[model samples]
Target: MSMSFGKSLAGSVLALAAASAAQADVPQVATDIAPVHGLVARVMDGLGEPALVVQPGASPHSYSMRPSEARALEQSDAVFWIGAELEPWLEESIDTLASDALVVELLGVDGITTLEFREGATFEAHDHEHGDEPHADHDHDHASEEHAAHDHADETAHDDHDHADEASHEGEKHDGHDHGDEEHDHEGEDHAGHDHAGHSHEGVDPHAWLDPENAKTWLDVIAEDLAELDPENAETYRANATAGREEIDAAMADVETMLSTADDVSFVVFHDAYHYFENRFGISAAGAISLSDATDPSPARVEEVRDTIRDLGVACVFAEPQFNQDLVATVSDGTDVQAAVIDPLGFELEMGPDFYPELIRSIGDSIASCTSSS
Candidate 1:
């Protein structure tokens, strides 16, 4: 009886060891940013932790991967990123270092909604009278026509009204108008030229992670990719992803509740990175201080943003930790606008499965706080 009992105990121990070994065979996953890393970490919760390429608080726009990060990419079985648009600097490194890894560009994933980049530093005020519908869905053709008609009327009025003083100031006014036109044209060209500086993609905004909907979609994508790489833990990966999606849904609901009072509040961002978040929540930024973070706002662009804030009665201006805080102060100075910091990258948040949802809530809280006081 004693010998038989000992045999059974040894058999049970061996079976437990085998189960542990099987569970340990997770794929080596690497992710680009903190948010992406957090999503991947959720899907890989019990399986393993994925390596983060770009550390939190570092700008993915102009990042140089360290040797350790490169080594992680080199050893990875799979790699995920937003794509070349957000981190153009990582493309070459991925091509060379992660040659064998299954590369998944989250931005190109299907079912994810991508928004176009707002053209200038200052954006046109978005009309939010349509409940829950994003400003992107609105037809701007009518507005464009009205603007053109107004410009034509202004030209006609100027031609007819100023003849009394025009004789004396004609040469001065004509020269000034021509010079102004030339300077405007030059600035436009300069802005257009830098559109591809940090983000190579012309039309698609790469900051899709700001939208909780997109993050939910990406959770499934990450699970499927990880499942393909490590079929042994496929069920665990998928279960984790489903749980993550549910968490995101809960977080989104909380954000909606938080921002319910902020519908009428208008604000501006340091740059046009929050459109996805704004669109998702049915809120909108009045304008951006700069078109892209890679380039500084031109003097004219700064003045335009100032005009937007004053004209629109914008209540708040958000600064990002990744960029200059002085710019936000400058834009909000001399106005009744309140200034606050919003970090989309989840830089200060503890990295893990909870990071994404917390990041979303933090953003909502930041916006609500400023708008509530104003």
Candidate 2:
């Protein structure tokens, strides 16, 4: 009996040693968004899966970190996020919780092309044949108060003459003094918050993954970072990243072919999150209902978007799965425009190696569906 017990203990010790050795090379990684996790998962296909911070069906723009998510960040070996511009809320939380982890800001990665949120960027008006006539000229500069007033007058000449001015004052007041305690707390909350000077909302467009070229760039970065962390799996990571790049390139071609079949299509999304996708595929949207999801668009802003749909002869208005569709329906109610759903976040899609391509391709399909029929 004593000999048998000694042999069993030796066997258990050997198994534990083997398990620890196997896991020694693996790093516990985490990502900020589902689409980003999809990319990282593809890169670490054979290696391991990374934790996702922003779960499916949640908007990264307005996500509040759950305690579980916070604990996950605390325990992660590496945390990858786009940047402070894409997720200002995560900036402070990450800094506070994961100060020791290898934090990567993908938007700041070299070779990734970042576009600015134009003061007044709109989709180019194209006919069914894809012939691009000059769309509305963006000559009205919003930065200059005089030009703003003049353009507001010119655009709203029909309705109550003082409506625009009154609304402008109301908006200014809301921004300055009437934002309420919740909004004020969000703005002033301190947990190693972001330096908003350069990365303000008006500066960078954070939808880089929508472009396949940028995905390829980010994949290379991911592989490189993982390689630095786990040299044993360096070759495997590089191979997976290369394969992922090829897959993304193929998906980009597929999107181009799919989107080309449709013409005379213009859309307005829930928010301005699809510009990277739009600019990549030459597919244009008329405008967005709001700038960000954190705050609701004012009534005047919604009315302005309604006017855009009418003036641009927009064919379809697309809302996001993560937001209320009633707003889209309201915008299209009396018009000939069709209301549809386009999800940029892959909120409803199964997330994995194929998620990035599916997200991009689905947007194309959604646009084609509405535009081709219209």
Candidate 3:
């Protein structure tokens, strides 16, 4: 089996190339939510894409794993999740999959001042309005005070905003600031605080990524986790995230610009997913919706929002691409708020691989176009 010198070197190079390709095969990281996929996509931006085991349209809160997805989970290098409380269904199998598979429940890692659900708080935020109460049109510097308090509270935590996003930025937790600290007279500006305990806010404003700032928080953790899981590719992951995060930064800039000039920058959303975006950009909005991801407004609830829209002079009524637009129309029938669609799910947008960033941009564009035009 003697070979020429050049032949032997060529053969060795070929073998090494093949081995590298096989080794670099992207990890089959299964996510508990679509937003996690966004994280994964950003992490894998320079690297290859991971297999998206769980998909859109499927409810992560109550999703049933298929045998194939189960197999993928078992084979995955890591399963990045917000936490079991956020996605209860995946808790059972998280440990059963594989011993080597790293299950990262990031909710624990994020440092937030969480406000536990009052009582009987289910996944339905629609069971109640965002936070303690829907805002009335009042010009209060509530947000500034809320941030001061949150920073004051986070006075000690390592991960300040990260914990807050893990808590989903429920309006109530921020609104739940102590009465003595309630200096802001603004109607809807009281949202602050993070639930570091991870007890539960039920499902109050679970679309943390909707806010560009929170998306950056999650990406920081995602980049760190990816580095830990694959130290060899640490540079690649960091570089990718740093570059990809610019998109989010740009999106934040865009949202800031859009909301700054919106004359009647307000809407009644089918869902309360936009609170983070609205609050972040200072866009005043009213909703005939609740905090839960899949809650429908009741007749009485619709009327309440309708009245608010009329009173607040809300410009647009928003709906999700997946939900019933008819409901939004029916509720906002005679009000000045025109029914428009906004997607927190990232379902309809062309996000390339990084769906979350694209989703944020899309949301910003929609908000800007709708509000400014209104």
Name the best candidate (by TM-score).
Answer: 1
Minimum summed lDDT over a 10-residue window in model 3 is located at: 166-175
TM-scores, all models, native as reference: 0.78, 0.75, 0.69
Clashing pairs in 2: none
Kindly indicate the candidate among 2 and 3 with the higher lDDT.
2
Candidate 3 — which residues are off by over 4 angstroms?
1-26, 58-61, 98-100, 111-204, 351-353
Q: Give all candidates' CA lDDT scores.
A: 0.73, 0.67, 0.55
Query: Which tens-of-lDDT digit does each residue in 219-297 have in candidate 3?
Result: 6656666666677777777777777778788767766775667735657666555555665665645554543434333
Model 1 C-alpha RMSD to native = 14.8
Better of 2 and 3 by TM-score: 2
lDDT (Cα, 0-100) at 360 in candidate 2: 77
Predicted candidate 1 versus true structure: per-residue lDDT over 177-267, tens digit per residue: 2211211112333443243223332456789899888888788877877776688888998899999999999999999999999988889
lDDT of 3 at 30: 68
